[model samples]
Target: MSESKSAGEIRLIRLDRIEVLNPRDRGSRVFDEIVRNIKAIGLKKPICVTPRFDANGAEKYLLICGEGRLKAYQALGEEEIPALVVEVTDEDAFIMSLAENIARRQHHPLELLSGIRQLVDKGYTFKSIAEKTGLAQSYVKEICNLLRSGEERLIVAVERGAIPINVAVTIAGAGDNDKAVQAALQGAYESGALRGRQLVLARRVIDKRQRLGRAAGRPSTTKHSQVSTTTVIRTYQDEVKRQTALVRKAAFSQQKLLLVVGALRQLLSDENFVNLLRAESLTTMPKYLAERVWPNGSHV
Candidate 1:
């Protein structure tokens, strides 16, 4: 409980004494994995906490990080857990919690958005949030705007990489007008913001959302069928384009392979080149080139 105590010293503390300052909004998949790992191998990392004196002069620790691990331990019914107590103020504890969550690579985008909103509500400026979270100001601003607009579906799609942010912005700006949305998609394609398969997929997602009446904020319990003639034609066209692209790539690769094979064949015939290869311990040919150059299994 001393302020001079170092965080490197790990101590066993009562679970009920430590408090979680900021909890992350983790999905069920993440929670289950954490529980499973903890149950299997035990806690890999100790939770960080700061000591504080309560009204009765009793020492109570405030957690700075490791909310998930704490939850897992609690779920496992563990009373005492390993904790690293650091000497920091209340503000520092909160900032550390925020930093840890934001710095995590696997943190959900929605959780990050929520944390940014919390910071904004706590009187932090956009610039401050950007600096603290190491995110660009424009990106933070855009996400904040999306949060303000209540664009939950778009947020999910963008986070999941189902659509680009620019495309989502264009679609969101188009409001309830399907014609305007289509025009915007066309403009996006022309501007090179979307290309080939991405453009096609974007169109399909928008069309599906529109047909389900979900794009305009309407709640419909009916599931719409997507087996129309137009959809069939679009699918066929996309498949053709994809196949054509694949064919072109394969042709290019084949040409390169032929060039390499020809060069290797010419080189292998040279006694000096073969001597150099022997000197360098490079006698074994690559499997692909070997199969192609020596189809009859005769050594060059």
Candidate 2:
């Protein structure tokens, strides 16, 4: 390794010498994108490296950041990559890994969590993690939550770019651990599983399935009571026609009633009818009414 201004600190190294810390950093698509960008525009940000020792008092460099870009450079058969060399402890190295990732925004959800977990396992609390990485406390908690998802498939999905980090965070907190596992494995949940306000409903589906399994052993009393498809259809058709006929009859009756009411209201308002009624009331009844009252006496 070449020594720079500082005697103990190595200044620069080959791109291949730096190692990626997080196992989940297998960024196939991002690497491809980086390669494409490099092909079009070229590398913009330099990678971060830390100092290490080899046998025989020799020095080496371990990559603390820019894993995706490094892979892209490697794919392009790059001769050199700009790097920063610093001497840091194992704990600092772990923090530096996550810090660089947060700074560069290169790691996936799982990779970010895996890096955070390394720092956590190294005795860093959420606060310490935030301070070291310059991330907010809420973001630190979110990263820890992402790591706690525990579903291998979900973790894989996050690594493979199948799901967004925010949705994965929600899925991690949701119930039905088995379904979560299934989602993680399948890279997606079943229909209606991820809908808003439908998580409880999804649980109901699981509950219903379980209830059906329990009922599978009991003899079905409904077997003998079941009607044939043809009989059911015929019965439904007959009922429909009967209801339709009743409706039509009722409609006709309503029309007749309305006509009779209209005729009575017209007669009540007529001047000739009113005068005839007044004359009949003064001991000179209508001829038809007089004949009915005195059937044999008057032929009016």
Candidate 3:
């Protein structure tokens, strides 16, 4: 039954009649959340569907969005589900479905990869994908290359925020040599693409994979061993060095700041220097320097 034209009246369509156009392999947590939410509060948003007449003159609805909600309803043994019928071509429906998922802030990286791959398969170029999905062209190209090269481990690392995408790309391009992988990791560290715990985790992931002969593109079958004492000592030493460098850098900055403050204070006390600064319109000192030079609210 239809109610209004503007709001796209909600209709109870047969569950089997609606086909999910773009289904994603979401994580269990997301699936469970959907199930829980739907079970507790019922469906909040009605799934969007478009109608297509079958060969037998029977109308079937194609789902544009809400695959998770549809799945939740199915799991609840639902026969008919609420849907909003929209008039659109198949291509438009697909685009709408892609947009709906991609527009979400919490959309999974894997889903984006899959969606991009689908677009590529459907004859969409990198530029077209970027335009349609609102993703950067470089990002689309890189992810597509990763998928093409079968870099599942790197993809997983990127999805988990364990490694930057560019770093992963570098590692993936580094052949099957341990030395090359190590070199890439070093480059990433030097370029500041990786730092601290992320750098450590990346090293571990890469090293573990390399020692077991399972590179980024290769299939992973190696189980990690217990952390060795030597490894622990090495990691601790690296952390100490990093912290020491940071401390030294901070100390140097503080010394420079103190010197600057002292020089500015000395210059401000001189009548000639103060007059020169005023004449040159350079009376405005930095906030930090001003705060220190005029701590008692005295005008300089």
TM-score for every candidate vs. truth?
A: 0.59, 0.46, 0.61
Per-candidate clashes, comma-separated: 0, 2, 0
Task: For residues 148-196, write the lDDT of model 2, one tens digit per residue.
Answer: 5444344444444444445456555654465663464234344432554
Name the top TM-score candidate: 3
What lDDT score belongs to each candidate, Candidate 1 first? 0.77, 0.58, 0.79
Write model 1 residue lDDT over 1-300, tens digit each, in one string.
Answer: 112435556899999898788865565677889999999999999999999988999999999889989988998999999998888877767876886787677777666766777777777778888887888887777767766766656655666666778778878788768789999888888898878887777876775555433322223223664578997996687677667757977999999999988898888889999899989988897787898877788664
Clashes of 3: 0
lDDT (tens digit, per residue) of candidate 3 on 1-300: 121224456899999998888876665677888999989998998999989988899999889898988988998899989999887778878877886787567887666666776788888888977887787899778888888887766776776789999998988898676678889999999999999999988987775544433324322223564678996996686677667757977999999988987897787889999898889988786776789778886755
Best by the lDDT measure: 3
Better of 1 and 2 by lDDT: 1
- Deviation from native of the Cα of residue 49 in model 2, angstroms: 1.0
Candidate 2 vs. true structure, TM-score: 0.46
Clashing pairs in 3: none
lDDT for model 1, on a 0 to 1 scale? 0.77
1 versus 3: better TM-score goes to: 3
